[model samples]
Target: MPLTLLPTRASYGPGDPIGIELRGDPPAAAELSVWRLGELVHRQPLLAGAQQTLPELPAGGYGIELEAAGGTVARTAIEVTTDVRARLRYGFVASYRPGKDAAAVADFARRLHLNGIQFYDWAYRHADLLGGGEQYDDALGQPITLDSVRALVASLRAVGTASYGYAAVYAVGPEEWPAWQQHALLRPSGEPYALGDFLFIVDPAAPEWLEHFRDDLAASVAAVGFDGFHLDQYGYPKHAATLDGTPVDVAESFLTMLAGVRDRLPDARLIFNNVNDFPTWSSASAAQDAVYIEPWKPVLTLGALAEVATRARAASNGQPVVLAAYQHVYDQAPAEASDRATAFTMATLLSHGATQLLAGEHGKLLVDPYYVRNHEAEPRTLEFLTRWYDFAVEHDALLLDPAIVEVTASYVGDYNDDLDVAYQEVEVAEAAVPGTVWRRVTRAGDGLVVHLINLVGQGDALWDAPRNPLGKTGPGELRLKFVRGRMPRVRVADPDGRPRLEDVEVRIDGDHAVAILPALDIWQVVHVAL
Candidate 1:
């Protein structure tokens, strides 16, 4: 006999109904009891071969007990708490085995301050079948067995991080290749298209394929005991067969699968990883909890990353936007180029609207020895990321809010062959307060916190420069402005995490505020109370 609870959260809010599922052979008699603080609140007879839903109860700690004729028994504790506003959480995925040591992976996760750990490609056959290949496998060919997964989950849980399973629900493995290639997503022609070597896109419209995918996903979810699924798909069109006998819309099928999964596991959190198809898959907003975009092709610089974050935030209706950038590609020649790219990306995302971060390691996973060895030589980059994790956790409240104001451009620059250089300067007729460069900004309690960055290192001396194209520095002082109300206390934080309280000169003459800084390359975070 096995009994399970749909939501494993120790706490729930008021008016939330509890779902209880029991699986066992028929019994002569069965009873289920709900207890609050050791008092029996409700008692009911259990029906054989059916799930039971407990009535909604008040918010408090609870305990459940079950008994049957054969002396079968089970008990568990539960808690109910008010639902606080959700904030942006960071996560990461680790693939490849680094010496088959689970602690190493856990250590890496802790260093990153990642709230979620994704078991990347554990069920795939290539890594499982090919043994230890240099190109495919890291150093150890450790297969992700159930026990290993459980251990990893426990490790993540110990560090207060959620665990999720990564899988391609609609793709076929290599063992089923060749024959399955015929059903692969075609490139307008009848020939079998290639989506890398391991994955062959299956026509979602095919009845047999759709059935196989649903079963596979459900079974994987049950076997892995993961909190949710990280669904990955190559957002591309297909000229292949359809499941319902008509031309299949791969994007629609993807959403259909997502909705079906949501129906099956109502409590599970689903995140979609489409490289750069957020606009096309906007329909997924209704089905998924978070929207993840991997903009790798355009190779956008820090400014471009900020712009994408703005667009993604709009598409998600103010949900968290995750920017997946390849640090190595930004500057591959210099040893510290990758680290600079990562820092710049994080800074840009934070300035935009506190977007999620995704750092990619090409040769091997973070825990791999090769990666560790290479990283040891350049330790500053690793240290920088560790600090970033700490910063994100500290300012979670400001990052999750929804308020924004535009000020002035302090400095602007471009990446010249991977080197970040500041070159352009614009002037404003009047000084303005701190403004949000990104489209969407998170609320900072009663005040609005905006992120400002200085691209030029030498601009620190330009204290009297105009704040914007139409504004000039007024009285050689910058003023903080708000939406024509009681002015609140203002605070600022530099890139190095220093905070200060100062009176800002502002002119809210036309639904705007202005602030002037004395630097060319400086990032300022302005906090304005509403």
Candidate 2:
């Protein structure tokens, strides 16, 4: 029998004792170790199959492990925060089909540690958001019910998770064309711009279109009680026109439409998808909670992911960024290959300070634009994701703290300064080199976090393609100047490894300090505390 441990809730607030469900070959004579950063802050005995509550912890990320008498360890990460939104872990709930359990959906999301959920494709029509009184087919001919939507909202909210209903910002079906034609966004040939035959594009900032959508949104809120809306786009028509031949700059219109929306619905949260970055620069400063990007062609590599995440965060003035980068390759790849690719995607996005929409609709994951077409996640994938998510939650501050600024260019490589990773003669660049270790450097206060992603075995850089296991890059060293003589206290962390975090010994030279780097596998973050 294998030992298993899971937290009862995604997070706990101040003064709340931590609870865990321990079973499945319960440990005999176990000791719990509670660690914060590189320090072991708390430790105590834990009993198997017992209703035990660990003492309340401070507001920060924690790594807890219970070592059984036989030396087996059942481990999990814990977050103690005043608000669940601090980390902003995101997920999706797309199933509104009959017989789908709302409570179960919420539970799955909680386990994923998602504080917000995009209720993907939970509407009858993109234009008429709330239809199908009890239950009816959606725009794509899938079962959906208003009752199911409301129940999901209530259930998710009960767990500290927000629910956002999905709606296309400027889309209407052919049946709605007559009412919205005057505001239609037309192509150069004078034909309406549409996504195939299903959704016709319209000027999002059109006065009439705004008013109509506003009413539909307001009504949806009154009925289903969602926290907000996820406004989507078909990612085209960068230049278009209204039916009356008025020229339109699609990117510029987002600000006007979003501003008007904020003015009308001041309390409603808004999240917009800048698909393939069709118009992110202008929309990033718009009134939205996070910068959401749905990457397709051209924006496919890990280096590109870093660029997008960095630029989006800067453009949004430090807003949350999420990559809706689906993994359709899972359809053709074997289970091991898919998991490896997923791990690569996680390393690329999360290490770049953005989250990925990896899970959705219960046990499924989004593999395509159509949320309903999600693939059932393999048990291996789920287990892998859960551990990575645990690692992410444990040190989100080091990874996403707005104060942490990139110093990769300034301090590493051909630099304004010198911070070098001692890899073999192979070229090491800030942007990952195929068959080389990718090093990204960042600093906040006296601490510097260097992310090392092993790209040593790959020939291609597509983030969604199948990945080969990392090549062994044995113990190396990170050498940097010791200006101001800030003594180093270095700690390394990896989600896929035992003892999630371990302190590494540092050596000091006359003018520099070197921290030993353990053999690289998937991804590792080294925090040099000064």
Candidate 3:
């Protein structure tokens, strides 16, 4: 018999009671345990088919473990935070029909701890943010209705998920271009910049255009109850001209547009797509909830992925970051290998203190830029995804806290022997070197975090290629050189293989604290509390 235990929502506020759905039959020895970090704080007998409303938990990360026959049967995690904006776990959905299952979609997102969802292409047009009457086809020829959109908005909001309507900031439909031609952005060829004659671009900073955009956004919220807008743009034609031949710098215009958006919708949550890091340096500090980027082109390798994440976080001045990286690698390879690729990219983003806009309606994953072209995640992919998101939520203080600073180069590897690490079959490389283990170290609020990623047996550092799983491995090693007054208590977790945090024995040998790792999997986050 299969058994499952899932939280009713992604996250709970301080006053909300935690709800757990229990399915399948439970053995006589079944028990539910609650853990905070390395210590087990609560345990009680549990029955199958029971509606469990857990008492209020303290504000912190927790591991909810279900055990039977003296072994852990299932493990999951939950977060009770005072501020959900500490980390923005984003998801998206493009399907918006009247018959769609809005409740089920919200359930899937909440289970994965997705607190922010973008309704991709759920509008009548870029210029007309709301549909006429109740039913209409979106700009991309997708059939959507106001009923479904509002249903999803209400469902997601019930679980504390903010709904963002996807709004193309400049694109105007072909039929609407002529009426607004005077506001169109002209190229040097005396033609309005357009996308293959399907849609034309407009000057976002124009007074008339800005007023139209803001009014439509407000109407969308009033019509369908959207919490905010996902501002979009095509990453081309960096420079354009006004109809009267006035020079226009696209980046500066974007800054002006964002400021106006913030001023108009001061209470709503806003997120803009910084496509390929274009003008991110200038707009990172703009009026957006997070520094979101859609990476492409040269950002195909593992090192490149990490670099882009770092760049976005730095440019944003540490508010929050999101990567809309579509995993086309799944289409190139079978599910067997593609699962590893999915895990690798997720690890790279989460470790860099950024979330991903990948998950969508019904637990699907966004694998293409066209939001409608989502793909079903393999069983293995789903399993690891659940664990990783759970672990991240449980360790938000270390992973998403802006006060944390990465110090891999100065703390680990060759010459830097502060917290040295070693592995058998693989050697710790200086950087993200393919066919070798990648080691990283960060200083967080509660402790020092050391991240280890398994890059073994990989042909190259490219993130878009399939990879081998971490599989089973022998023990690894670690040694801390300088031991101060506080004898560090070591805690380790590999969300893929071990979602529960385990307290490892730290032997104090004179001035050093040493330990032996049972194994290293796809990724492991080790926290040493001083």
Candidate number of the best lDDT? 3
Over 4 Å off in model 1, which ranges?
Answer: 1-85, 95-99, 126-144, 178-183, 238-245, 278-281, 329-335, 359-377, 402-445, 457-477, 481-488, 497-522
TM-score (C-alpha, index-matched) for candidate 2: 0.94
The global Cα lDDT (0 to 1) of model 1 is: 0.49
Order of models, best TM-score first = 3, 2, 1
lDDT of 3 by residue, 1-530 (tens): 46667787888899898877776666676788888765787887775466566778888888888888869887777788887766689999889887889988888877788889999988887787764668988777788888999999999998888899999888899878877889888878898999888889998888889888998998888898899989999886688888888888989889999999888888888988889998799999897888999999888887888898898888887778898988887778988788788788888888888877778798788888888998888777777678888888877777787778888778775577688778767778757887777888899876788888888878787777788655444677878875577778888988866676687888888777888876877888888886
Q: Which candidate's TM-score is highest?
A: 3
The window of 10 residues in a row where model 1 has the poorest summed lDDT is 415-424
Which of 1 and 3 is the better model by TM-score?
A: 3
Candidate 2: tens digits of C-alpha lDDT, residues 1-530: 56666666667788866887675766566888787775788888876455457888879888777777676477777788885544567788877876679887776766677778899888778888766676888887888877788888888887667888888889999777888888888888888999999889999999888888888888888988989888888888888978677899988777788887777778888888999886888898887788889988788888888788888878866778888989987897987888888888888878778889878657688888988778998888888887888788777777766667888878876445467787764456677678888888888667888888888889977788888877888886888777574676778888887445578888887677888778887888888776
- lDDT for 277 (candidate 3): 91
List model 1 lDDT by residue over 1-530, tens digit each. 44432223323457656655554453557788776523478888876555676778765445555767765365444444453213334445454443455555555554454555556665545213223233243223433445556666676665445666765656665667655554556555554444666456776545565565556656655765677777766656533453233466676667676777777768776777766644434543657666677665453445456656666666676555565544443223343444444555566676666555443222121322122322232455555554454445334445544354322333112221211111124332211113212212235545555554543322211211122221222122234334456544444444343322234554444533445433322344555555
Go through the candidates in order and give each one's C-alpha lDDT: 0.49, 0.80, 0.82
